[model samples]
Target: MKILQITPFFFPSIGGIENYVYNLSTNLSNKEHKITILTVNTENVQKEEIISEKVSVYRCSLNFRYHKGLISIEFIKRILSANDYDIYHVHIPFPLGLEIAVVASKIHKIPLVVTHHGEYTKGNVFFSLISSIYSKICRNISLKYVDWILFLTSSYSVSLRLNKKIRKKIKIIKTGVDIQRFSATNDGAILRKKYGFTANDKIVLFVGSLSIYNRYKGVDYLIRALHEIRSVNNSVKLLIVGEGKLVSELKELAKELKLEKEVIFATSVSDEELPYCYAMCDVFALPSISGPESFGIVLLEAMASGKPVIASGLPGVNDVVKDGITGYLVEPKNVKQLSQRILKIIKDVKLGKKFGRNSQRVIIEEYQWANIVEEFEELYNNAMCKNGDGGT
Candidate 1:
């Protein structure tokens, strides 16, 4: 089927939502289904959108508040009107995504499927109120001919707070990665050794776009957990692999806690280097708080890298990591519990390896992009099955 994915940013930009579109669309493209992305016309992206035998990217050069293409409603209309896609699938909650999809559904008489992939319901009061307005608007537009809402986790499914009737339209589909591209390896032997990390020192990695809003990615919790963790084992080192506004502050706190030498803030690491970073880790950590993280993509990557992980026991992360099996899940923002779990993995080498292997097994079974896209393709066919008529 021909699928058109609408989002603000695409490849070259780093984000979970962007990864969802890239990996799923590319996987579908490889399967001989036509896939195209409608995104922002950032200065760096010269082509409006890429078109190939199986995949196409259409970039609209319109600026909005935050690269959301919020300023160019007509541009979105043009993109939607120009394409004769079998299904219009949107991957975000922005005005552009909902607006363009709504218009396209009306003009083209296609079914509209929205994938709510974030924790939109847990933001601050102002955002919560604004999101309420947008959610209502989205629900109204969706209810007209909505076929399905693909939520990344049941937690997010509940977070959307859609009416029970509308909730029936929700389906739980975990975000996926290219498992073939990521596999269990030991980047530590060469990569870590060269990077001044000794085999003796435990390396914990965190990857994501850090912002002021998500400082409690539980990175701070990791730092706080350090006081307890390092009391006995001081060989633990942290590799924070992302850049954001909180970089400078985090650096200072590391110094204040005397962990400056123990923590490495690594941003701008290339894609080729990412797997190695994960492979080098003795264990991986994704300590995101409830609502701060909708789905932990890094957890799967860690599993694929054959590294045991410890994530916050929030809905999305817990849904992925099975405690004492694939990985352990502790309470959100609980530094003590997080520290204790970290100590467990570090202390018991056998249990650590067991968790890592189990993680690999589970991720291979459920988190691979090849398997995940089929679920999406099915949803798309259902969405497009509905014509332009407001017939539900």
Candidate 2:
């Protein structure tokens, strides 16, 4: 099938959506399907670049952007007039681009598929409210023309609050991770030794950006929880990976909480070394407080590394980590609950090991990239089969 993936950003950009489009396109390309990514040239990316034998990318410049979304009437006209694609798959939440994609798909009569990557809202209340209203209007119009809509989680679909007309088009397909690189045997000892962590020290890992915009990742709450966790187990150490605007503030927070020694921040790690960061940890925690985190891909990465997870009991997370089985889920931003859950997994070695094993099994069986690609392929086929038949 010839697939055209329309997204706001592409390779070289560090974001969940960017990674998703790259991985999915490359995987499908490798499987003998033609895949082309059309994204904004925000970072001066090549106008045309070959990612693989079957995959290529084309970038267009944006005239203006609000938050992470782009607005370019010329780019839309160019995309709409393009005639090479067999199917049009749009990754949405960017209201402006999305509206254009919808109109283009209808004009071209291309089977349209929409992937909702959570609510792409940002900025303060007044701006956020305006954006929300605009996004909803675009979404409703787009849904009326889309052949199908893919959602990462059921909770995310619920969050959309779409009516029956649009809701029936929803299909839940999770984003996936590479399993081999994230295997349990990926040695973290070298990294642990470099970080001055003793073999006996229990490492709790948190991976993701610390940008002020992403404060909802709940890194602050995790820092607060560390005080309670250390009271019972001083050997426990917190390893925060990634960098952002909030890095200095977070560092100051650790110092103010007197957790300087207990918390070690590794500002950055390369893609190849990220698995080791996960493998080195006894448990992985993500305390996201917002609905934007539709699916915590980091949780799967840690699970693939054979580590137990303790994350916010958000709807999306609950779908990935089974409470008390693969890992424990605590209420979002509840420091006391978060701390207690962390202790539950850390204090008991055997239980922790069991959870880790369960996590690996779950990831391998359900969250591998290979399996996820097949699911997408099936969806593509279904969309094609329905083409010209007025199927939704």
By summed lDDT, which 10 consecutive residues of candidate 1 come out lowest? 383-392
The alpha-carbon deviation from the true structure for residue 195 of candidate 1, after best TM-score superposition, in angstroms, is 3.1
Error of 1 at 295 (Å): 1.0
Best by TM-score: 2
Query: How close to the true structure is residue 266 of candidate 2, measured as C-alpha lDDT?
Result: 89
Candidate 2, residues 224-299: lDDT per residue as tens digits? 9998899888989899998888889989999999999889998868888888999899999999998888788888
Superposed by TM-score, candidate 1 places the C-alpha of residue 340 at a distance from the truth, in angstroms, of 0.8
How many backbone overlaps does candidate 1 show? 5
Instruction: Mark the regions of model 1 whose C-alpha exceeds 4 Å error after superposition.
Output: 42-44, 49-52, 66-69, 121-128, 136-144, 388-392
**Estimated TM-score for each candidate:** 0.91, 0.95
Model 1: lDDT equals: 0.75
Best by the lDDT measure = 2
Pairs in steric clash, model 2: none
Q: After superposition, how far is residue 67 of candidate 2 from its true place, in Å?
A: 1.9
| Native-to-model Cα distance after best TM-score fit, residue 259 in candidate 2, in Å | 1.8
